[model samples]
Target chain A: MSKISRRRFMQISGSLVAAGAIPGAGLLTKSSFAAEPIKLGLLHSLTGTIAIAEAALVEAEKMAIDEINAAGGVLGRMIDPVVADGASDWPTFAEKTKQLLQRDKVAAIVGCYTSASRKAVLPVLKQSKGLLYYPTYYEGQEEDKHVIYTSQEATQSVISAIEWMAKQQGKTFFLVGSDYIYPRTCNKIAKPTVARLGGKVVGEEYAPLGHTEFSSIINKIKAAKPDWIYSTVVGGSNVAFYKQLKAAGLDGGKQKLLSTVVSENEIDGIGKENAVGYYACMGYFQSIKSPENEKFVKAIKAKYGQDRVVGDPMECAYNSVYLWKMAVEKAKSFDVDKVTAASSGIEFSAPEGKVTVHKTNHHVSKKVRIGRARADGQFDIVHESGVIEPNPFPKL
Target chain B: MTFRRGNQAPRRKAVIPAAISIEETFVTFGIFVMQLFNGLSLFTILLLMALGLAIVFGLMGVINMAHGEIMAMGAYTTYLTASFIEHHLPGLMGVYLFIAILLAFAVTFAFGYVLERGFIRWFYHRPLDTLLATWGLSLILQQTYRSVFGAQEVSVPLTTWLSGAWEPTETIQLPLNRIFIVALTILVTLGVWYILHKTRWGLRARAVTQNRAMSSAVGIDTNRVDALIFALGSGLAGIAGSVFTMVGSTNPGTGQLYIVDSFIVVVFGGVASLLGTAASSFLIAQMQTALEYLMSGSMAKVAILLLVITVLYFRPNGLFASKVRA
Candidate 1:
């Protein structure tokens, strides 16, 4: 309330400014004490058709961030996540990726569940020279310098699954899928693999995405009487397909069915009773017996509640964060080029055992496990392959 | 497209052998019969969905874009009811499906009644406004469902009685769920026919639809009739949703999948003619099911859309236009 002379006020204000600036300047000079949190963008569909699956990826990424921060932080800087919903729309994914990279200036992004969403964001990432750690098993033949694919490609998943199924079961196969780029491409890989393994594909069919009427397909399967059914159907359609299969009395006991896409999340939706005994091949399963997986599962359950199921994508998403951390540390900076260069041979003791980044393709090498679904909506690991190098482009 | 080729190559290779052998001919016959049943079931569902739209769009001239969301509400209702039965009355789980269907209809009926009074009434004559408004309502309702029930797809437990199929031959199997859906559709269609032709409300509704001024002058409360008709249409959609749970998982976005198909069914059929709705749905469903066997599902879908567009281009009034008092 008291008024002072202008010179006196100016002198006091200047000293106060200097007093604040000195400590701030000192703190800024310390390399580890920048005080600004390193932000990582998480672009996922939190609402829409894909939300059922992508929401879990977001949670897994957050859990990884929390665990990394708890373990003395990443490079002595706390990890901050910038989450944005793509709304299950492809263009929205591109827009959000740009916003995250350009506006939020996140060090790296871990996102995109669907291949379409990933494809949409790829151009933006390429333009911005940003790094994206994509974590979904997809059709192969794509390799990008700006992206690190943490999950399996078609060769590692669908082809491996087909080879294993043909060896284990009979050679004859029936292929069914949802009408989309991923399923169609996976089936394209599956057909030649089945043929190469001396197996004849009895029937192959595709239903439109979100198509619930699988009665005709089931009937076709019945007539064809294939030794095994390989389905790449995804999303809500999976629930209907499995349920209709069960209702038609064609279950695991009557006929063997294997999938590259079905996991704990899908089994949860299709109901355990319907999905039980079906085999799914993926890089990780929740029931993997490794101590690393045990701790990962425990931490996730503790954070997200016991009812939340962790599937391949979620585990891959978790692995991506740690992989990014390892790369950043190896590069000693968050620069995209440096991190990408340092990413080769970067290893993370993932929940699925050890996963190493391939030297050239920016894809990871990991073990593939075939798991049989249990009544509790968890997988029982049936077969595990030793670490297989990723093949982004495989000759048919 | 490569996958489509992959699918077709095997099919074509298989077909040559199928065409050559008499034994394969029997197998082909069995498959054809099974596909017929499949097409019938699809037709049944499409008919049920289009019935409500036929009444609302055909009779009331209101484009209820939220019709699918109303169906989703019914599906969620069944899911909740089944979950409740599972948790609280496991002993009655087998018999709970009937009760769930009834509850689905009633809940959606009341919801439609409220929706009519609150929002849809204002945009009665403005078709485009009603469409936009109902679409906005659908988004709101979808978000509401997501918030209330979570975005995850939920499935209703199948009763033990409905859990398996009826196999008449070694090669042919009929799913009990599809049969039940077909029967339910028939019963509902009959009931709807009886209501529209034999009841006082039907006569009033028909009069109002045909000549609104004359019906009003004759002391009929057109507003009340509109609400009842809308609610009835919504209730039918709820029934369709309840039946849908037998075949598919229910999610917040489940309704969107059916909206366009149902609209196609209603508009392709004459909007006001129930018979036209049934025939068109049957034709569309059968053609789609048959074409899907010959080509990729997307290509089949493209074919169906083109067919529908061509048909509409020729007959904008629909397959069977009813003459109303002008």
Candidate 2:
């Protein structure tokens, strides 16, 4: 038997031996590798600014979990999903992650919306030796042994977006972003890439995170007359920025905006009327028209109801749980070490074509899709960077 | 006489040509037109946010830091209503905004009433304690909202009339939402004015605000007026929040950003006088908006705060304080 199977057998057999003193002692087996339900923990920001995005992830995860459970569960045993709310607080994410890892003793935990929240929970997950499936388009410096990044890496998402903008629009790029580590790092990567790609960084400005006014920034953009705006601004601020941009008469056909973070979900706040015609770069758009994507979309709609909106992060999160299931089944054990070891180079058919887990850095190979906001709060996929390789650790 | 005045204007204009310079003319004209509209719009949102806070703080003197949370509740109400309209009543999304905004006011008003009765009523006189208590309450409300709503932003859909730019000009394209907010503020202010100046409840409320013992002796149920005022204020805040959904995102922690500004407006407006509140709101909004044009938003905020402090330092009771208070 393998070392993991041996450890599992010992652990199971030890627990069974302890339970052998109970009424079911007769049915108790000596083997530790006996059929056991795998318990996975789900932590999410259920009640804060991130909650709107985070709730969809939880729903997607549940849908995936249900599908896996319906298919006789992973490794012939049922899957138990233990959910905990992060409450949108950074410290709460860490606290809840600890509860999931220590108290619940889940096999693997899938959670986190923001980089800050993910960072807060990283040490807890590491110390407890828990596997984490982080689904976010984050600044890709972090390469944790325990994390399996199911979303697009920051460099791939942002770089591909800039390249696409340069080719489609002219080569003048203006960087606009919310003043946060993610946006700052994203802008940092974008500025150099713009220079390398023979483009000019006209005017780079930072708005306070959750800032609403964009008149000044918009005026600066109009004055600078950049070909396309490269925006990394996130959250509630986007609503104000997009509205103000439209209000200030610099919208759609007049001036093209290429945002790294704005997605179908953001369109809800920005209103379709204001957001229509703005280009946003993300891995997943709602309008992907593949048979696999259709089925995935159909399934999600059916599970969450037709009125529910799906975004890139939600799709990645849905894929993450199923990907974990595939990894667990391939390894044929609940042991984190064995599961992780088997996960590397593992391929799973996702909504975004075939996604393969890069063993070295743990990020999945993803397609880069640039979509424009439609009139009805949905995205129209304008460009797709087919099967881009996951480069989690860049030579920078 | 008209021709003489016009002809004299040319001779006088030549004598003091510096006063009629193109740049100075534009500047003055810009300030005059923009500041008037700016004052009106600022008063609209300010009144919406402060009307409820004024009652809560003005009557009970309970420094409710969670008033912003109440506004968030209203914004979420509008979001949910928009969702409902999109789902079940697609044709009524425009009309739904009105219903949703009104519903937000009612719901938050009820919520504020319950909150006042449950916990806030006990700590009426303890301003510092109430401040801490309400701050804690605000945190709890924010967390509860996050737990319920999730972390992602849920946008409230606006009708074509309430979305996008209003003006044809590229230089001065005011958003339709801002227009709607301005209109809503006027209607709300009028409603508040009617309640405070014209109604029997207003008399009792004002009497209680002036001196609680005197109002009670005059057979006015001060307690009832306090509760009603609190609800009215919360409802106004709800309307403000609902209107804000046109321009802002609805989130659990979104309230944190506005509460400080709401308090500043109410305090700077003078605690008791509604007219004082209106004046201060205009001053602050105009200062912030105009200064934002001159400097960065963060720097402008600091400048406005400094201006408020300087003004308040000279006139301790605020710019339009009551003669008795001064």
Candidate 3:
């Protein structure tokens, strides 16, 4: 080492301090910002109609953050989360995304439940050069560079479900969903897939969101007498749909109805007895028989309370945090571009088993599952499609 | 809640079956009959929901924004009752609903009494103030319910007797729960009518609304009458909430979904005419059921709401506006 005067050493240290290499605190936040907490934004509807589902998602994400901080955090820095309320409004999602990106300047955002909210946030994410780890299984029509979809896309979920139904069940499907962009788009793809698989889509209907009446649709379904009914009804309306379906004598044992939306959380709301005999497809289930999943469920319940149950999106929301942490570690920096680059082809040991970030599409490759809802408010895993690749724009 | 993959193609992992058996029959006639039945089903439920709002708004002249919350209280009460029965009276599972209904009424009745005494009574005669104040009360009640019974919806298990459908023919199936709701709606509607028209309490309620100071001078105990009428209205709403659990949800904001529709029903039926309320709900329900059968759910809803607006424009006093002294 070369000998240096005390005055010269002080000057170098002063310049380093001024440059913020050592942060504002003397020796606390050091290692070129490694010691400082990396701020991550968590956006979800904490209030309003969507809050019943989205609020729990926020809890799942926070649980991940708490777990990450408890263990050694990514890049040797504690993760600090900036929570934003989307308030179940699309414009609010855009506003919050802008605030999270431009104001708080979070390294990455993990949020949004509805596809509308995701679409609202997309433009803002791209413009701000921010990353969003969206956890919802949505109608995929884009491969955005600024978004990393942590859940399955249409091909990984809806197509796989329709294929299974066509093969094992009947050839006819009555496609139904809550009238929204996601449901309409899903049905659009589903109709083609059913045709491609040499199955007939007997009838298709879109009930308005929050619609509680389904008797007329059930009447149509009965008239159509399709082998399977593919439903995409979401939110509080699900309770009415399931209850009415059961009351109409079309139950799990007879009428083969499978929903892409209802999960353990929803089944809990729809009542186990009401959902019994129906089917749901997802990337994860609380009953997934895996040591990793068992641990995840146990740990989540231990923290969130045993009364609380985990669902596919909740698991994916939890996975988004870990996936982002892995990306940050792989890049060895929190730079947006670097994280995006390192995120490609990243593999995570999620509760849903091994989930991989697609090399190019920015979506994940995960297992697709179809489970029959049992009376115990849990799914009985009936079928599993081996890890399926994500395609944001599937050629029809 | 639902997702799809974007552009690109991949072979499905499953092997395609060479042939699939699909039934080609669609029972169009049976569907027509079912659509009419669905309208009746909707009418019964809507009437049950609107009955309480009609009474409260017609007699009190108070626009209660928290009416939904009061109903949610009933739903939560029913849920609590079901849980209790499941744990303690497992054998009574089949009839827990009846017990739950009575308990929901009593609980919400007490709650309504206190609410009117502490909160609503102060805002009497100031309709707009009641609207704003009750709106805040509704929010507070929602948060309170959220704290008490987590934010998640609490579902009440339907009894076996109420779970099945009565199928006269393979295609013509009527839900047992809806039938049950219909029977209950008729009984409650009649009971409410009897009380309002044939009872002394109803006369006092009517007198106070007609002339509060005059009724007070005539020794009606106008304040007590106001509290009782409001409590009775709340109890009815509670019953509506209990009935709603069979077909709808039970959450903190469960009240919100029905609030707008409830107001629409009351307004479209003249302000103080119960018969008008019943008639309007019937018309609205039948229209929705028919439109839904003929078109998309969204379009049906738009058409129904548009009809209500158009009618309101033509008859600002609603379909059965009274010619009584103003």
- Best by the TM-score measure: 1
Give per-residue CA lDDT, model 3, range B1-326, as digits (tens).
22344222223323233222232232565677778888888998888888888888887888999999999999999999999999998999989999999999999889889999999999976888999999999989988887788777888888888879888876678888898999999999999999988999888888888888888998999888888888988999999999899999888889998999999999998888899999998999999988887887889889989998999999998999976432
Which model is ahead, 1 or 2, in terms of DockQ? 1
Worst 10 residues of 2 chain A by lDDT: A23-32
Model 2 misses residue A320 by how many Å? 1.9
Give me the displacement of residue B48 in model 2, in angstroms. 3.6
Runs with alpha carbons beyond 4 Å of true place in candidate 1? A1-34, B1-26
Name the candidate that leads on lDDT. 1
> Highest DockQ among the candidates is held by which one?
1
Residue B236 Cα positional deviation in candidate 2, in Å, after optimal superposition: 1.8
- Write candidate 3's Cα lDDT for A263-379 as tens digits: 999988999888888889999999998898998999888997888889999999999999999999999889999999999999999988999999998999999899998878899
| CAPRI class assigned to model 2 | acceptable
Interface RMSD, prediction 2:
3.8
Q: Candidate 2's residue-wise lDDT over B1-326, tens digit each?
A: 68879878878867788766776565455444444454456556666778777667755666888899998899888888888889999988768988998899889989888887888878877788888998999889887776676665666666766656665433345557677887877778888889899998887777788888877998988777877878888888888888887666677777876888888887887777778788888787767666665665567778988988988898877776764321
Which 10-residue window in model 3 chain B sums to the lowest lDDT?
B17-26
> Candidate 1: what is its chain A TM-score?
0.94
Question: TM-score of every model?
Answer: 0.93, 0.83, 0.90
Per-residue C-alpha lDDT of model 1 across residues B163-246, encoded as one tens digit per residue:
888889866778898899999999999999999999999999999999999899999999999999999999999998988888
| Candidate number that wins on lDDT, 1 or 3 | 1
Count of backbone collisions within predicted model 3: 19
